[model samples]
Target chain A: MAKRAAFDIPDGAYVNLGIGIPELVAKYVPEGREVVYHTENGLLGMGPSPADGEGDPELINAGKRQITAVPGASYFHHADSFVMIRGGHIDICVLGAMQVSETGDLANWSTGSPDAIPAVGGAMDLVAGANAIRVVTQHCTRDGQPKLVEACSYPLTGAGVVKRVYTDLAVVDISGDGFQLVELAPGIDFEHVRDLTAAELRPLPN
Target chain B: MIDKELPTAAEAVADVFDGATVMIGGFGEAGSPIELIHALIDQGASGLTVVNNNAGSGEVGLAALLKSGRVSKLICSYPRTAGSRVFPDLYRSGRIELELVPQGTLSERIRAGGAGIPAFFTPTAVGTPLQDGKETRTFDGRDYVMEHGLTADFALVKCSRADRHGNLVYNKTARNFGPVMATAATTTIVQASEIVDIGVLDPEAVVTPGIFVSRVVGVAEPALESELVARGVSYP
Candidate 1:
């Protein structure tokens, strides 16, 4: 049971997506469910992308790229958007990851560099506000080092923020015990995934 | 002279016209423009379309405006959720508008607006729901689409330090939207936690040079409450 499926979309939930990888969730959001898309930029009720020459320059999502407004959509001060997030209105925040600790701490911002570009952005607010947080990323670095670590080496973006881990190679759940093997990627088995992971792997129930 | 009395962010904004678009700069919670927002509340400015990155939580930034039922439209990335007390109420009542954009594109639009470019070209929005309804053209076998620059009648910003002449110096994390927005607004108003001497500020450290700022005001930590807390400060 590989947890990383390209088509597993959440339903009718308001989601705040972090940059880079999480934005892909919009493309796979489930049908027949009223999943209201939110951007930290102060927009709600946003729809899927529109056809060329049909897009309004003024309309866009939190990522700051142009997007279409949903039929019932509305707007507010940029600060108000954070109110919604920090105030606990968001259900899930799908974030990309630099590293994930066994205790679910997210260290996505700095590599100890003063010049890191992303700067944790809205992640701090999302971590505090969102009831559930999911991470989408590759399991390892370019040099074949595992990103799922025993303890994050970088400054943390959010403490204990992650609930589920969906990587290209495996799906690991974070708990007090450790990285529980919830599922494995297709063409790979538990043994192979465990060998590549930095943290201890917990076997899923048969 | 130090003044203790003031209005609120919602009260000030209620007086603004129904369709007024405002530009607010801040990356996230770090650099949110809140002072002018407080004044807008006192003025009762309303029916506004605000542009910025992410709104603030209840007591700290744009969240106060959302709670007050003032802003009618938003051009930003983050949206209010079900648990967000006031924002959800507003959303449920059908009184708000939300827009989401790519973070890079949002910054670029403000920067483009500041630079006087009518619109810029980028491939950032090609495939996602972000690309719908935009114009696209090709250059050298590469496709580039147009995303319009952003501007506003009023710009509200917070500075770590400011001079009497209106130059601004912001610390790290807080520089997100201030500098570019300084150029996009017709009359930019700035609030500094500490107003500094004219010559004391190093010219190199000034993110927004004085020419871009129109008004300078100083506030203590409490004035920040309205910008931060949706319940707002007591005086307003």
Candidate 2:
């Protein structure tokens, strides 16, 4: 799913990847394209994880994992770093989602369970501020429940913010009408993908 | 002599009073002033309101401070992180109150507080649960939620280098929230790895100017929170 999402990113995009599968998109950006990675914790031109013994605790990503900086990387304070986000300077933001509504609403931050500790982080800012927002996730939950739904039951991170979704079954675009199929993963049929989606899935256009 | 330098972390935080709103700068453990926080822990001030990006990881640094039960309220973006049991436990038990702000909004609030802006409108959390009960207005047909500037009684920050005058330079991504938090606090205390001479630091490269900072403590070799947590070390 990550590799498929990477294929859609235009060259020279300033991209912010949310933790989890979205983080892997940087590694598969088709070699020739130069996409600068932005970590909302205040590093631009972020590099991959450092060697086992060379990790610096202070030089880490948004996920709080040790990461290296590219040679041209620049560090700024949180305000300026977020300016790149809230000011809409970020070209693309790919995030992991718990649920996405047919209207492009994103619900990745909270499950709304009273027992769960609600943590928002930068997910709302990324969805609202980035020029384009994409989500990469599994088509269904581990228990086989569809994540693409008519309406999000969880607390939303942002409303009507997602542009596209890359899942294990298909690549779907959130349009004014609803979920429009962009492309299917190899050998995945339209009916099979639609069966797993609680929302209406429009087949690919001719 | 314009010496803002202090000899110990305990001395730096000695004057912090109970019920003070303090901003502890860091995104996770990076740029976290652990020594200052530890000192604050030992200082034993209670009913404190603490601000940071994350609550803290493991039973060290901010987590350790939270575990000590000194902080009564936390203002932050994300509190549930890997190995972050302290804040969650306190929050669930209704011992600690949490004001969960979105990351960018939190940063802007600190920046605005420092810059003397009382309140600002942002489009970040509009139409979400975070926008509930906040003042909302539309400008140019786009909706926004109003957020107030957040100031603090004190700010605890960590930096890579500092001068006697309190000018600071941070290392890598560890610079998060330190500069803005320094400005947002009445007394911004800093812990630096090296305290250099004034003018030794390039004027153009200084991340935080001296006027915002109140005191500086030198921790030539600061303890890494990850290692401390790895060793199962908890604070006193």
Candidate 3:
């Protein structure tokens, strides 16, 4: 999933990776190319995670995990980091989503669960601010429930912000005619994709 | 010799009355003013509305402050972390109130408050639940929600170094909300790890100028739970 998402990131682009699965994209960023990672906690030019026992308690990412900074890295206030995001200074923001509608709406912060605590974090700001966005998630829930749907039943993080979705089963793009399948996983066919998706899927062009 | 340094942390925050809005700087445990927070707890001020990045973590610092039941409301972005259980328990049990703001919005609001800007618009939370009932307008085509500038009666910050004039510098990512929060409050109190001479700190290296800071208290041993653990001190 990280390798697939990395292909979409252009060199010298300022990118913000959301927590969870989306953060894996940083490890897969093509070697020798500059992809500046912005953490909403206020560090830019973020480097890879530190090795065990070498972690600095003070050096952390927005996800509250220990990380390292690359050469010439800079830090700023949390507000300025968002200004970089909301002002469209960030080129790409890869995030994890709980649900993606056929029309490209995103719902990732909350599942509308009554007993669960809702933590918005920086998802809202990143979604609304990025010039382009890509969502990475599992195709279905543990119980075989599809995440991609006709419309999000859960609360939305943003409206019409997701452009591409990288799931376990396939890579799809939000299109006028619903989810258009771009590439299928090896050995998986259209029938398998259709069976797992709750939303209508448009077949790949011949 | 203008000495802005106070003798004690308690003395630095002595004037903080009840029902005052205070901005506490920190992102997780990095730059948390744990010593100052302990002083606030000891001073026994109540009904405070705290503006911060995270609510608090574990059973010390901000978490301990929240657990004291003295804080009436929390104005923060991310209130939940791995070790954060105090605010959740208090909030669920009707002991505390929360005003959840996006991390960026929270930063900008405090910054604007200090910079004399009343309010501004952005597209961060236009269609989400956070934007509900907020004044929004169309600018150049897209929708933007109006967020007001946030200021506090006092700001408690943690710094790595400070001169007698109150000019401060921070350590690494620990700088988090310190710079912005310093300007957004009426009385900005700092807990510095080391107090240097005025000219010792280069002007170009200062992240927050002395003009915004009202008081600086020198702390020989800044109390940080993470640092304690890193030094092999078992927390109580």
Candidate 4:
């Protein structure tokens, strides 16, 4: 799934990777494209995570995990980093999701459950400001419920902001027709993918 | 030459009185002025309005401060986290109030306050519940939300180093909101890892100019939660 997600990033694109699985996209930036990584905690040219015993305590990502910095790296205050995000400078943002709507609404920040912690760190800003947003998540919940829904029951991070959904099972694009099937995972058929998705699926012609 | 050095964290934050609006700089526990916060906790000032990125985490820092029942209100972005029990407990019981701002909006508001701008428009929370009561306007045919600049009576920040004049530099990501928070307050007190001579630091290396800082106290031992956690020390 990380390799599949890495294939979509264009060259020289400035990108922000959300915590969790999206962080893996940084490791698989296709070797040639100089994808500039941005962390909401105030780094511009971020490199990959450090190997064991090589980590720097102060130099970390938004996830609060230690990471390395690429050459030509520069730092700014938290405010300026958001300016890069909210001012429409970020080309792409890959985020994890609790649920994604057929209409491209993203509900990743919170589940709206009473006990859930509502930590909305830069999710709304990234969704509203980034040129494009892609969500990475499993096709089904741990309970086996579909995550691609007709409408998100959870509180939305942004309305109609998601451009694509990269699940472990399939790659779906939110379009005018809603939940267009872009590609399926290995050994998975259209019927199997459709059964796993709660939203309506429209397959594109060959 | 003007010297703004203070003897101790307690002395540095001694003037942060009750009911004061204080801006505590940090993203989680990174740039948090832990010593100053502990001093403030010892100072026992109640009904304080605190502004920060997160309410608190683990059981120390701002969380410990909030746990003391000193905070009456929290004006921040991400107010709740898994390990943040102080805020949730206080919030659920209605003992404390919250004005949850978007992270970007919070940063901009602080930056705008420091820049002397009254208010600005942002597209961040236009269609969400956060924008419900805010004044909205349109520019170039696109909708934007109005957010007022935020300032505080005192700002407590953490820095990697400081000069006698209070010029500051920060460690990597730990610099998060420290620079902006220092500027947005009437009295900015900094906790420095090392206090150097006036000519030791290059003018080009200074992130927060001395003009914005009112006090600087060198921590005998400068420790961050990330480092502490890495060392297997209990963070809270």
Task: Give the winner by TM-score.
Answer: 2
Better of 2 and 3 by DockQ: 2
Measure candidate 4: CA RMSD: 2.1
**Angstrom error at residue A29, model 1:** 33
Per-residue lDDT of model 2, residues B1-236, tens digit only:
89999999999999999999999998888998999999999999999999999888888889999999989999989999887789888998999999999999999999999999999999999989999899999999999999999999999999999999999999988999999999999999999999998889999999999999999999999998888988989887
Measured with C-alpha atoms, the lDDT of residue A6 in candidate 2 is: 95
CAPRI quality band, candidate 1: incorrect
Clashing pairs in 4: B59-B236, B60-B236
Q: Poorest 10 consecutive residues of model 4 chain B by lDDT?
A: B227-236
User: Model 1, range B69-118, lDDT digits (tens) per residue?
Assistant: 67887777555322235555565566776665555566667767877988
Model 1 misplacement above 4 A: A1-206, B1-18, B80-83, B222-236
* Candidate 2 to native Cα RMSD, angstroms: 0.9
lDDT of 3: 0.88
| Worst 10 contiguous positions by lDDT, candidate 1 chain B | B2-11
Q: lDDT of each structure?
A: 0.67, 0.94, 0.88, 0.88
RMSD of each: 17.8, 0.9, 1.9, 2.1
- lDDT digits (tens) for residues A64-173 of candidate 2: 88999998889999999999999999999999999999999999988899999989999999998999999999999999999999999999999999999999999999
- Candidate 3 stretches with Cα past 4 Å from truth are B227-236
In model 2, how large is the Cα lDDT of residue B102? 98
Taking all chains together, each candidate's TM-score versus the true structure is 0.53, 0.99, 0.96, 0.94
Better of 2 and 3 by TM-score: 2
Candidate 4 retains true contacts at a fraction of 0.65
Write one digit per residue (lDDT tens) for candidate 1, span A1-206. Answer: 11232245466778777777787777665466567878776577767666987864335555545567777876543435655775678887788888998888877655856332222346655765667888898988888988898888876765666888899888888987778988777788888888888888889887
Which of the numbered candidates is closest to the native, going by highest lDDT?
2
Q: Candidate 3 — which pairs collide?
A: none
lDDT of 4 by residue, A47-106 (tens): 988999998667888887788889988888998999999999999999999999999988
